[model samples]
Target: MPALPRPATGPGSRYTARAATTRTRPTPARAKPDIVALARRLTARDLWLTALIHEHRVLTAQQITRLAFTSTRSAQRRLRTLHHYGVLDSFRPLTVSGSAPEHYTLGPAGAQLLAAQAARDMTDTLWRPTSTGRIAYSPWLGHDTGVNELLTHLAAHTRHHPHTRLPLWLSENSCARRWGDIIRPDAYAHWTETTPHGERLLPFFLEYDTGSQTLARVEAKLPGYAAFTTATGTAPALLIHTRTASRELALRRRLTDPARDLGLRLATASLDQTTDTPHARWWMPLEPTAGRLTLTGLAVRWHPLTPATGLEATDADTPLTLPVPPLPPAPHTAP
Candidate 1:
């Protein structure tokens, strides 16, 4: 028999595990879309959506609506338009349930336009024609969508509420780039809540769990976070969002010993437990029973934690030469 080829391996193998196992959908042979025309037709919001899709790898129609649009129907209408224009591509995963929401990724013309706006060559953008297909077929698609869902809810809250802001939201890739040595959180964020006295800031590392990994594997992540705190002299409260209430209980039980030993500020919330929004009193501390607390309440509870330094643009050790602003651009107003 002929020898089989070795699988691709590198520093990024952990992130690309699904790539080797899953086959990308074949692209149909068709004429390339008019990139220049699409670029000219792109609006501020359209460009922002393209950039966001590029950054996060994938977003569901519902998530995009929560992040930008005013209504589900309108968002769907606009998304259809964009998808038809070859500016966005989408896939609906087959679920045991009736149907799944459409998930969106940057299309070919969108990638070219985005790269052009950034004054970079197509090769530098790291986007390929098959990128969307890879995302669609990956097992991690649901987990990624869940991560975006939580953050988008928080970001969208600012629209209706006054004096609340999501100042910073770093994706898994961004978090890894910044703090990969000691610990790489699924997401790192800053939420500012207004108090009568002044403003209170909540900096947290999010671990969105789908209950796929073993409890041991989940509990094993604590020491790295502790080491990070010790090394940086800054502690960000860790919030684990679980799929079910039972899973949250299991994790809390599994993690309590080490989390206490390491003196890590940890909390867990489950999807079933949160009735209103993520901002509601859903998060429960890993410690003894009291009651659920809001995200801001967790901030107040973990007062000892400090905002991470070197994250600002003026800081010397900042990761990106120019950090991406957390919020998208405001709608252009007619003067």
Candidate 2:
């Protein structure tokens, strides 16, 4: 017999090679649900129940009802709804000694739903004010100005309490008040206790001076805040100068002088320009300095202010002396 014909090395081999390559490729992961849609379905009660099941694999309907403070009927209804939604899977034994308790466990879909809900909640908590779709109405506060930058930076830095709580007192129009409006500071802050006369009900008063016109406009409106505070018993006044050499210093003196007078003293930070570090971009008290300076008062703790720096030159003075490689010749086309 003729030597078995040698297999042809051509298109047949190429086809087999391509088929193998295609089989080796990985399938992409499934995407999670739409955040808005998921959030809409997540009731407070649902969240509570999901958390309960996540902590314990097998929970009785009665146990869930007791923990959630619902009647047996309500609990059963919720359980049935969750079971229908594929949030939970249930099983009932064929033989029961007494009244059979229905046991429930989170299904794969339920676990995924809970995880997605947790991620969305974290994101919502982080960027609260701006995430809520409210615009910054203080026209005097410019876009990307020092205060706005500070607010954005604080939003990131103060994700937890103390620093985080300060934002609750500020609003879009927080700084806006007619000439005589009272400055109502947050009475809840322990810092307000340091003020003389327990006048925590009064406003802290803030004023921004853009120019002579702005100053005159604010001066006319200041009394409204004072009258409002007196009537409501909430302190609500502060005047912040947008531009002025002694602005911060003057404010510090006014705040701290009374402490010294009362003999129940507090230390104050000096606003000396020469002592100003680059981190002094805003008037943040140096972190936990000695003595009574340790108290942060109503001020929010921000990240250490970092100045923008320029990139260093890679090749200084001398030219790049290494010879460049020659280019490949252009391909010739068949005539």
User: By TM-score, who's the top model here?
Assistant: 1
Worst 10-residue lDDT window, candidate 1? 5-14
Instruction: Report lDDT (CA) for all predictions.
Output: 0.74, 0.33
lDDT string for model 1 (220-321, tens) is: 899998998888899889999987777787888889888999999999998787633998899988887747999888888877568765465554332222
Tens-place lDDT digits, model 2, residues 51-166:
44543333456445544432688778777766655566554322213333455555434666655645443332222212111212222212112222222223223222222222
Q: What's model 1's lDDT at 148?
A: 83
- What are the per-model numbers of colliding residue pairs? 0, 45
**Which residue pairs show collisions in model 1?**
none
TM-score for candidate 1, please give it: 0.85
After superposition on all C-alphas, the RMSD of every candidate to the true structure, in Å, is: 7.3, 29.8
